[model samples]
Target: MNSFFDGYVNSKTTLRLFVNQYENALRDKVEKENIAADFHSFKSIVPCINHYDIEKQFQSVYTNSKFQEFQKELTRKIYYYPTFIKKEGAIEVYQVTEDMRIGDKRKDVVYDILLNEEEFEVKCSCHHYEFRGILCRHVLCLLREKRIKEVPLKYILERWKKNVKRKHNFIRCTYSGMEDTSVAKRFDMLCNTFYEVAEVGSISDESCNALVEAIDKLKILFSTNLDNSAKDLHVQEGPSCDGKSKTILSLVAVRSRGRPPTLRKENKVDRKSREKMAREKKAKKKEKENNVKGHSMEIIKHNMNDASSAAGNLASQDEIAQTVLVNSSAHYNTFQTA
Candidate 1:
């Protein structure tokens, strides 16, 4: 069915598409120097999104194939600019007024693009050439629209929706055991990007060294910590609150204390009893009404019979009176006292 929401514009995505189209059109209209100048002008005029923040937000969601596709699309818009992903689609701009349930905030923004038929809203932040992630505000905005969950990755793409084969091949390196030369280089990289200095005893040191990127490795050192904390608290409801959670008795701490009233065990019987009583009352009322209706019908039938009998008797009486008058007149004409 073509429902109410089917025709509604995706305000955010439309605005994003508009901005993208506008940027591209302006670039095409100008010289290379003008493009560089435009970049500078755009930076000064528009708010910039932080690259690090976006990268961190994206890191958790990047494993999905759709997200990877979006990344590829963004890459094309920038360095690749491939002709395969057609740029002929119309970029529509719109505005949306969303009332957030949680924060209770109403947002009004100059929309960038309501693109991909409202699949996603395209937004820009100054830090990088790539798209922005679901910032808390963006999430709130979507929730206000009653979207219920995070926006999917496909709607944010700037290029083809398919993943492209990586252009660069991995190069293998030979290692010598003496100095562990890769370690120092990796350590320096980590220090620059992450913490300033990794402790000797810390697992941060493991990723700091060149042997491996610190994806999820090096948790052995903190295994005991993770176990003690994870076992204590539930992962679903909340994070470990000082790790004091007990499995069974934790509810006791949260539950109110008092001499509570006793609860009935046989609630089903009570409900059934009440329902039976109500049904009996309804049936009795119906029977009484039926009896009244029957009595009224009998009375009406008797009244109609009485009316018919009275009319027949009156007609017979009229005929007899006429006959008697005719007889009297005939006797008078016959003459004499006889």
Candidate 2:
């Protein structure tokens, strides 16, 4: 103790003791009186924090349960007295210890916190900020010990903020029509829109069934229309490569007045083939219905015949029973007379 006091006197360390003691006394008084500091609204207390950062902190603290738990932990006396080591540059280091004891266990967790005092940046060895995008209790405790009244803006990550997705370019449609637009582009748009509707409709079975029925109706309508309009289309030769004529002809529509060149006609043979296919389908469906009805009628007739046979057998059994009773009565009377 004498050597420590002598070293303190020699190094003139006690010169700043009055200021440190005064801050400690004020903190103790605040704690004793239950006076709380409003970190959100205390703009002048902590450095490098503005109104925008305050709003972001509020949003993150309220919405994130983990952050709320961290706040609760910050209120507890978990961290030990932080020790600072000043370096030659703007970066300084703080050592913090936590009493992680359970029922007399002496386990202590220590962390090295790095702070750029000039830039108001803080980081801990736990990597809580790196992994979870939030300041750890070690850094928060050091900040409190240093008399910082508000958290710095650099500690508040953008991802946790409520206004993260407010920008217009975050999710924009990429399906603008262009000269290079192909079937794939239309297909991509189709899938995007279809999935949006499907996701909503998939919430309930009724909605899903409604969507399915609507799609079925659309399919029928499109198929019938395509079959009816097939004859108006024609096939023509397209540009070939390497002086080779391509066997596959491109289907082009017969031009009409006031019609765009992009319009293409369906092949006449395709229309006839589609009509034939539809007729075959109808014929098969009718045959299937007739077969089902015939099978049902045969089942009914067989059941009726079986029921009549059963009724006749029951009647014969009753008649036989009556005859046996009469014979038994006659035998009894004869025996009595004898």
User: Model 1, 1-338: lDDT tens per residue?
Assistant: 11311222233335654444333333233333333443343233222233433333343323243344334433332221111223336533333332335466655333222333354544422212244432333223323343334445653342321122122211222111112345445655665755533443255655456434442355566665665553231111112212231111111224458966678675888989989999999999999999999999999999999999999999999999999999998898887655
User: What C-alpha lDDT does candidate 2 achieve relative to the native structure?
Assistant: 0.58
Error of 1 at 323 (Å): 2.9
Query: Pairing residues by index, what is the TM-score of model 2?
Result: 0.31
For residue 220, what is the lDDT in candidate 2?
Answer: 96
Off by over 4 Å in 2: 1-67, 101-105, 166-338
TM-score of 1: 0.22
Runs off by more than 4 Å, candidate 1: 1-266, 336-338
- The C-alpha TM-scores of every prediction are 0.22, 0.31
lDDT of each: 0.41, 0.58
lDDT by residue for model 2 (229-307), tens: 5433221122212232112222334668895665677799988999999999999999999999999999999999999
